[model samples]
Target: MKLVSFRASGADRLGIVFPENKVADAQQWGAANGMDVPDSMLGLIDKGLEFRDSMSAKVKATAVDDNADYVYDYEAVKILAPMPKPARNIWGIGLNYTEHVAESARSLDTDNKLPQECIIFSKPTNTVIATGEAIKHNGNQTQQMDWEGELAVILGKGGFRVKAEDAMDLVYGYSIINDISARDNRRQGQWIVSKGMDTYAPMGPVLITPDEIEDPHNLQIITKVNGVEKQNGNTKNMLFRIPEIIQDISSVMSVDPADIIATGTPAGVGAGRDPQEWMWPGDEVEIIIEGIGSLKNPIVDDTY
Candidate 1:
């Protein structure tokens, strides 16, 4: 099932996106069916898998019912990031794709050798913006802003030292993330300021449960700027897959519910281009991941 966090009636509510582009108010559906439901996406995730499974079953069984009162046209509501306010900064995996590593090496003037392990980075919670939102292009701060389209994993259960074999069990769902970066702002290899600027992370159109996806690694990731395709690659090219990523991070720190881990982008970013492409005002960026959905956003100049 496709789950979403949307704004309707001047309030944020949890929703389920059904066929025909309809979004059902999940809380209201639960209430009508004599089932208790959380008002927000994070609240529902915190309820654990048993509750989520039960709710998913119920939704699937009764979705065909004529529940016009709670269902709204998808376009009528404003969709927000699956986790609007993540409990912590979003975890980012760097150099996970071999081709991306090579391209990055050329752009950064570093050695092309691949990392022996997953390279982790963090994008602050403030960096997140939902689909259709504007990505702030601050000319003073960065003249070489670039995009990295990645698949983000949302953790359902918290744990330290999670084993790779059991890592999949901790996942709540998956979404798309555009890891916007300022190519020139890297200060001595540190990326927090360069990549964590406000509106830098564009996430979501919807969150797809694990049940809907058979193999995350087999999916295609395509990115486009304006109307032109920029990045076309598959998750199979990832040097470090999801399981190892979870185990690596969990070995050092606790992975908690609502914590997002972006699995890194593919090759073909603007910085890797011959002439070097950069996004400016009046441009739009769109990321499409197979089975998940499309996350599109406009680029706007920072007036303040």
Candidate 2:
């Protein structure tokens, strides 16, 4: 089932997108129709995976009555990251794509550039923004702003030392994450400040269950800036797949339910380009992931 979190009429609600791609208030239906998912996605996660499964079944069984109307149009609500306010830490795997690694090499001196093990980093919770939100195009402070379109996994169960074989079983769903970065800060040496700005990470229109997608690592990812296609790539080219990432991270710390793990971006980020182009105020950035959805964020002048 396609699940989403949206804000409408001053209240935040969890919902299921009908086959028609319309919204059905899951929280309302769950309460009224004996369906028992707690009001929030966090509540559902805390309730456990089995509880979520039971809830999904009940939601699917909810019949559309002739007299009942769909709660809202798809476009009527403001979509938030499917699981906003995620449990704790947000982990990101970098340069997992071969082409991205290759392109990155060209940007560095021959002596300093080469493919290695996955480059991982963390983004504070404050970095997340949703589709249609404005990205802070903070100039001067961050003269080189770049976009990295990535596929992110949301965990359904928390665990330490998780095995690769069980990695998929722990996933809650999948969503798109725009890992926006301040390239100059990256060059300055610490990634946390460079990539962790508020509104730097824009995620979601919705999250799709694993069952809905045949292959998580094979979808097409494309990014457009002002209607111009700047990045085009596929997940099939990932150098290290999801299982490896989970195993690597889990070995160090516990991976919690609703915890987001960004799988890294493909080639074509602005930082890895010649004459390096960067985003400026008035630029519109849109990322499309086949079978998932699109994320659109406008680059606005830096107020700070």
Candidate 3:
């Protein structure tokens, strides 16, 4: 199921993506049907299977219940990040892809040995940016900004010390994130300053449930800047897949419902380029993960 959070007429709305790119307005549909479905994505994440089943049934019923009038043209509203602001920092892993590790090492003129374990990082809540928003260039703070297209996993159920085998139970769904990084500020091995800037993570168009994805680790992920394909790789190639990542993260901290996990990127980031490239004003960046949908955002100076 493809679920979304949209903003229109000065209010936030919950929706389900239906056939032919149509969006069924969950909030309005519930009110009309005398049902009290969760109106927020966070509520849906915590509502669990019963809510999902109910919503799915209602969405199907709307097709024939001509009076429902909940389905809307997908373009009528502005898409917000499925989970606009995660409860906490978004968990991130670096060097999880061999090619990325190689490219990064080459760019930094360092050793190419693989990270011994899951190298995790955190993207504070402020980094979250919706698909249609602008990725701030922050030209005043840093002159160069780069992008990392990644598959983001959202947790529906909170868990701690979770086992690798059972981690799937904690999954809510998946979205795409552009782990936009500021190469200049990523100094002295500390990425917090470089990665924590506002609008660093451009996420979503919608979130797709596990049932919609046959194999979470086999999707084709691609990133294009201004219509030119840049990063292209398959999720199956990640060194530490979803299971391992969940297990590793949950062991250290309690991952709450609605938390996000940005599962690293494949190679071909701007920083890895021979001469390096930085996103500038008006550059459109599109991160497309097969099945989840594309998240496209434009680059703009911090001023506006």
Candidate 4:
């Protein structure tokens, strides 16, 4: 089942998207039926698999009943990031794609070396923006703003020193993320400032449950700027992969429920181009992943 967080009546509410382009307000359905459903996505995720499964089954059954009072057209509501306010900063992998590593080297952004271990970074919670929202193009801060489209994993369970083989058990769902970066904002060797600026992370249309996806590594990830395709790659090309990423991070710190991990992006980013393209105030960026849907956002000048 596809899950979403959308704004209705000036408040964020949990929703389930039907295949027919309709959204069912889960909170209202739960309240009406006397089910103990959470009002927020994070709360639902924290309820554990048994509860989620029970809720999903009921919601699916209700859809069959054809309830219209709590359902709305998909285009009518304002969609927010699956987790509008993440519990913590988002964990990101850097240069996890071989081609991206090479391109970063070519662009003088990093050394031409394949990582011996997973390269991890973090983006502050304030960086997140939902689909159709505007990505702030702060010209006074950067002129070389770029994009990196990647697949993100949302964990459902927490574990310390989780075995790589058992890592999949922690996955709750998947979503798309555009890792926006300001090429000229690098300070020292850290990425927090360059990549963690406000409105730099564009994520979500919906989060697809693990049961719907056969193999996460086999999906395709494509990115486009305006109407022109910029990056076209597959998850199979990822150097670290999901299991290894989970194992690597959990070896040091616990992986908790609702924690977001943005698997590194593919090549063909604006900085990797020959002439070096950058996003401007009027441009639009869209990222499409095979199992997940498209996440599109426009660029706007930052007044602040």
In terms of lDDT, which candidate is strongest? 1
Best-to-worst order by TM-score is 1, 4, 3, 2
Q: 37-114 in candidate 2: lDDT tens per residue?
A: 666777766777776677767657766442444377777887887777766757988778877777777773322343
For every model shown, the clashing-pair count is: 0, 0, 0, 0
Which stretches in model 1 have alpha-carbon errors above 4 Å?
Answer: 64-67
Error of 4 at 26 (Å): 0.7
**In model 4, which regions exceed 4 Å deviation?**
31-34, 60-67
Rank the candidate models, highest lDDT first.
Answer: 1, 4, 3, 2
lDDT of each: 0.91, 0.82, 0.86, 0.90
lDDT of 4 by residue, 216-277 (tens): 99889999999899999999999998999999999999988999999999999999999999
How does candidate 4 score on lDDT? Answer: 0.90
Evaluate model 3: give its TM-score: 0.94
Report the C-alpha lDDT of model 1 over 213-303, residue by residue, as the tens digit: 8999999999999989999999999998999999999999899988999999999999989889999999999999999999999999995
lDDT of 3 by residue, 99-187 (tens): 99999898855459988779999989999989889988877778778889999999888889999999988888899999988888877
The C-alpha local distance difference test score for the whole of candidate 3 amounts to 0.86
TM-score, one value per model: 0.98, 0.93, 0.94, 0.96
* Angstrom error at residue 5, model 4: 0.3
Off by over 4 Å in 2: 58-62, 65-70, 108-116
